[model samples]
Target: MKYLYGLLALYLASWLFTLPADALQQGFFFWRGQLVQLSGALLIALLAALLLMATRPRWLEQRLGGLDHLYLLHKWCGIGAAGLVVLHWLLSKSPRWLIQWGWLTPGARHAHQGASWRGLGMELGELAFYGMLLLVIISLVQALPYGRFRLIHKLGAVLGLMAGLHSLILLSDPLRNTPFGWLTQLACLLVLVAALWSLLGRIGRARRVTGQLEVVSHPAPDLVELAIRLPRAFTRDYQPGQFALLTLDAREGAHPFTILRQDPDTGLTHFAIKGLGDHTRQLVQGCRAGQRVWAEGPYGRFVLPDEGATPQLWIAGGIGITPFFAWLEALARQGQTRCHTRLIYCVERPEEVLHGERLRQLARKSGVALEIHTRQQQGLLDPRPLFTDPQAQCWFCGPQGLGECLASALPAGRLHHERFAFR
Candidate 1:
């Protein structure tokens, strides 16, 4: 949220600094031009930020609180860019409509040296705007399949480069002399670099490792468990609750899944994926033993905090229980039996509950109280009944609605939740 506010403040400052002294007195046409300039600057800044975020830099992820928070910010950046595009279009084109309606008269144009270049810039800008608009719309629509959504999302890089070219060519003389212009130029260059990197399919390449699937099993109708054996030379370590991006098929792209188990002795990494989307469904159907796959990550900050003996409540819904499963394994391996922990596992049906016996075994060995809830039998879970200790911290990994409901029932800073879905 601070990052979001900082971007807004930057936009405001740039707009104020670039505005002319007689911006208002110069007439509606002059104000329109200023407004377009301001919107264009803001759009470029947001586009640059989106590209940087796409790179998934680890430092930025930590500084921004987590990759989840980064995605939230990325979402807002897309929305803001879309809004600014609309604003710039209206400001620059409304004068024609006003004149046609006889509400205002046409104003004289200022002569510029690079009129031909500016005309080309305007054409590029218009093309970029429409392309961006389509991309943004497709992204916002939840009904759009993930496969198509992912492919469409990459177009932002292309349109971003075009927008950068447009900005460089059409920048006003006054803006070109100011620090704001220099910053804008820097942003454009970064956007171009990011776009190229994305197009090259080299995102997060350094962290990636190739492995062979040793086991693929179906724990339930919609759930799949995968174990991959990496080469002995591979040396990536992951916290229990972290997730990784797996690329099974080049055309399908990489998808994020929580690391359910990691066996250091055997060099085997495990992941549990539920068939919730097209990609996941494909993974469940096509994945097999001896299949080669790529994984890049060990990303996420959802691991348990080192709060000694503080009573903790762990809640999971459906496949959201994946991370908690990892945490339980870590606890069992470490023999941390003194921590007072309560786990609430919720599912629609008893059959849908994954690793029920294993969870209970781990809980007993680690001295944790476990509660299983079946929606059909027990109805919805009420967190109010479970909040017996005010000092206890609650960790949730579930649907957004469930998290929101629990957050409302608990005190601020007392509840932490995992956000795995990024849009």
Candidate 2:
């Protein structure tokens, strides 16, 4: 949230620096024009930020907290951009409406100029706006299949290209002479470049590694565990609590899943996928041993505390337990545990708990206090009882509602939760 605030502040500052003082002193007619300009600039800036987020830059992930946080920021930017585009469109066309309503006579302050290349630019901008609106709406719709959503979402790149051209063609002369103008031009260029890069399927290409599905296991009714063996030449380094984008099928696109565990000796990366979406259901139904998969990550910053002696409270809900599984595996391999860790595993039903025996075994061997909570028996998790230690760092991976409730109850900055839902 701080990152978003800082971005908004920077945008406002840049806009103010570029806007002429006389524009504010001018009549309502000029004021409306200035408003339109401001809205357009903001819309382009938001689009530029969205484009950069699509690339999943590590630096941004780190700065913004994590990849999940970056996605949240991306979502907000898209919404904001859409709003600004709508405002700009309405303001630009309001003059004609005013004239038609007889609120202003011909050649009056609200009079609209004749159409030209500028009008064509406005038309293209409108088309791009509609495209973006549709994409954003589809992204918000959870019922839509992820593969279809992904394919349709790429149209954003086309919209970005169109928007860049529109901005370049319709920018006012006063703004063109200012520093903001050059910044705008650079932003447009970057947007176009990002769109091209995404359309070319170059995002995260360098980090991608090819692997074959060596094993598949069904630990629960809706869960499928996959073990992907990487090529012998590939040497990958990842923390226990990180995730990777797995591309099982080119048409379905890459979907992010937490790395359950990785065998160092065999170089087999494991993923425990729950059948929650179309992609996961497809993977469960269609994926087989010996199938090829492209993994393009090891991304995220949800690793354990580096130097903390305080007791750690690890809370997981349902499938959110995947990362904790990896952490326990790492702890087991290390042969020693530093801090006192407590794991509260929660699920709607006992049958939904994956690797219950493995978790119990690891907890005993690593000196972790484990508590399993099933809603059917124990009811909702009572987080209030766990806040005894003020110094304890609470790590949560679960439903957003659960995270929010725990976060609000715990001390500020003590509750840490990972963002799982990309959209």
Candidate 3:
């Protein structure tokens, strides 16, 4: 958030510096100039950040904390960009509205030769704004099927390119030779390049590796487990709590799934997916033993404590238990028992628990105390009794409302969780 606001302030300062010194005293039209520049600079900054995240740069992923954090930031940028587009629209059309109400008269300055080019820029900008707004609306509708959502979301790249062209056409003439002018042009260039990269489907391309499904089974109702064998080691270093974007079928596109188990020697990875959505249901039903797969990532930073790190409290709700399995498996491989960690699994029913036996055995092997709470057995969770020590680190992956409730009750640095809901 600091980085985002700092960048905005920097851009605002640059644009403000370029404005006429007497801008405040120059009346409505002059103030309008300042307002439009403000809106334009901020809009460009938001789109630049948004498009950059679409590229999924590893360096950016690290700087932003993780791919999970990156997704949250990307969401905010999109929302801000959408609001700014509306602001810009109002600013652009208000003059005509004012004139219609006979409140402001058009001067000879409004009839200049450059007006034609500026009009063209405004037209293009309006079109881009509409395109973006439509996509944003589609994204906000949670009812949209995941497969259809993935397909429609690709149009974001096209809208970003449109916005870039709009920025280029509307750049002010007086600022053409200035450093700020070059900065504005650079923003447009970045937007265009990033859009093209996304449109070409180059995101996470380097980390992607081919694999084949070796085992697919259902242990519980609506639960499907996949064991895939890769031909080579992952492109990026694999971690226990990290996840991969698996392309089970090209038509359904790639979806993020937490790695339940990964064997570096054999290059075998496991994913336990719950059929909560239509796309995931398709994946569960369509998965086959010999089906080809594309795995891109091993992304995320959620990990248990090292030898000297702080003790952690692990909380998993329903399908959220997936990553903890890998953590336990990793600990077992290192022959490290008596690890200072505790895991609490919460589910509505005992039958809904995934890998109940394997989870208990792994927890015992790893020397972590395990607690399973079901609505019928233990009622809903009471987070207060759970957090006995305020200094202990807490890691939660679960339903959003419950996570938020737990987060508020924990200390600032004690709570850690990934934003798994990608949309």
Best by TM-score: 3
Predicted candidate 2 versus true structure: per-residue lDDT over 1-423, tens digit per residue: 676577667767877886566755776567777788778877887888999999988788888888888898899888888788889889888888998999965555332333366777887898998888788778877567777778788899999999998988888766887766777787788898998999998888877889899999999988899999976443356888898889999998888899998887777878999888667887887879998899887788887665467888999999999988888888899996744888999999999998899989988888888989999998898889898988998999988889988987898889888887887
RMSD (Cα, Å) of model 2: 2.7
- What does candidate 1's lDDT look like per residue over 244-335, in tens digits? 88889888788888888878677788899998877898788988899889888768889866746578899998888988888888888998
Q: What is the C-alpha local distance difference test score of each model?
A: 0.84, 0.84, 0.83
TM-score winner between candidates 2 and 3: 3
lDDT of 3: 0.83
Superposed on all Cα atoms, the candidates' RMSDs to the truth, in angstroms, are 2.0, 2.7, 2.0
Off by over 4 Å in 1: 20-24, 231-235, 308-310
Q: Which tens-of-lDDT digit does each residue in 1-423 have in candidate 3?
A: 789998887777777678777776787876775677568767877999999998889999888888999999999899999999999888877888998999998744644336667777777788888998998888777668778888888988888887887777776677655666777788889999999999998888988899989999998788899989874568347878888898987888888999888766666788999888777887778788998999988788876557456567889988888878888888889888756788999988899888888888888998999999897888878889778876788888878978998887898878889888888
* Candidate 2 wrong stretches, greater than 4 Å: 1-4, 18-24, 106-116, 232-235
* Total clashing pairs for each candidate: 0, 0, 0
Candidate number with the higher lDDT (2 or 3): 2
> In terms of TM-score, how similar is model 3 to the real structure?
0.94
